[model samples]
Target: MNDYAQYEKDCEAIRTTNQQLLTEFSAWLKTAGLAAGTIKNHCSNIAFYVNEFLLYEEAIEAKDGFTEVDAFLGYWFIKKAMWSSQASIKSNAASLKKFYTFLYEKGLIDKQALADLKEDIKDGMPLWLATLARYEDPDEEDVW
Candidate 1:
């Protein structure tokens, strides 16, 4: 197969794996006693992160996505998601934290990686919210 063909194949496999992971994550959330609506929202946020943003440019597995949270929330999500707002940004960050913690407990990621992801979310949230404000500002001269 050609390179592009291989890329497509890889992406399909990743999507399938991500779907299963999401199912497992949802079940895990339920075991933790999260409300149904909260579980749904977390799964939805993670689904978009892994399936859409991760796969947008390459076949990035959810296991490898911890590193991309900064870029995703700091720019891509703010610009791409029509529902982007301060509240949504914070919500997504919380969802990601929960999802990654679940992944860590399942041994999909190491402790250090989980810690780093949490730290990145904590530190980057301010900038991500600021970016959202600028992106949504009608009067901001340089939104990008």
Candidate 2:
């Protein structure tokens, strides 16, 4: 009886659209057996993108709205500049490209927007975390 009740509850929870999709994606990722670190990285990147999208929506004062792809990238990535590190920003950009590509493939966005997002990343920006993580070469043992 308890097992059956639990199964019923799980089935009921799976009926919601967002829950169903999230469950399916999670199952797929689990079956794919990605490294734990990789899964964390991907999830973090996706969260960052979604957070920026929500911020963009709020900025426009739209009651119920999503930013066009251009406005999202331009304002979130180019204008506000919220990244703490170059590597982190690069990772987020790569994640956005993958995410928008998925959306475009699913017919959720126009192809032109994705195409316009393909500009080369500018190099030479020092990542703050990477700078902090640096340590003196172990062979050179002297330090004041």
Candidate 3:
């Protein structure tokens, strides 16, 4: 099989489970009384994080540890996404926090892993933005 064919196979393997978790995360947000727009944005953010980054790194579920989160926020998103900026970095970080909290409540990731992930965000955020600065136009609106 060609490379694209293998990639497609890998994607297909995770699709159902990925959709189920995202759908449940969406419902959980609704139940939390989040606004329609907020729920949409969070779910969209998580989907992109999972499907594009984590899954690309071979993560099949929300049970992964801090290394995955750090890599996504610190590197791949900026490298892969055209719209990346300080605001987007911050926004996706918030979304991932809430989404992972939900997964924690659902007993996907353990309490220790969640705590470490948050710590990873705190410690590594500066470096992530500095890396982003290399690619960002300082004069751009919302570049921060």
* lDDT tens digits, residue span 1-144, model 2: 686676555444433432333344444445668666765675566554454454433322111112343344433443355553446656655655555555566565576756655442222123322332332235533321
**Least lDDT summed over 10 consecutive residues: which range in candidate 3?**
57-66
What is the TM-score (0 to 1) of candidate 1? 0.97
Q: Go through the candidates in order and give each one's C-alpha lDDT.
A: 0.93, 0.45, 0.81
Candidate 1 structure quality by residue, lDDT tens digits, 1-144: 998898899999999999999999999999999999999999999999999999998889999999999999999998899998899889999999999999999999999999999999999988888888888889998875
Ranking by lDDT: 1, 3, 2
* Best candidate according to TM-score: 1
Q: List the residue pairs that clash in candidate 2.
A: none
Off by over 4 Å in 2: 1-36, 56-83, 120-144
Model 3 earns a TM-score of 0.84
* lDDT of candidate 1 at residue 110, scale 0 to 100: 97
lDDT of 3 by residue, 1-144 (tens): 987787778777666677898999999999999999999999988888877776674645555634587788788888789998999899898898898888889988889888888888888789889889965766665532
Better of 1 and 2 by TM-score: 1
Clashing pairs in 3: none
Q: After superposition, how far is residue 12 of candidate 3 from its true place, in Å?
A: 1.7
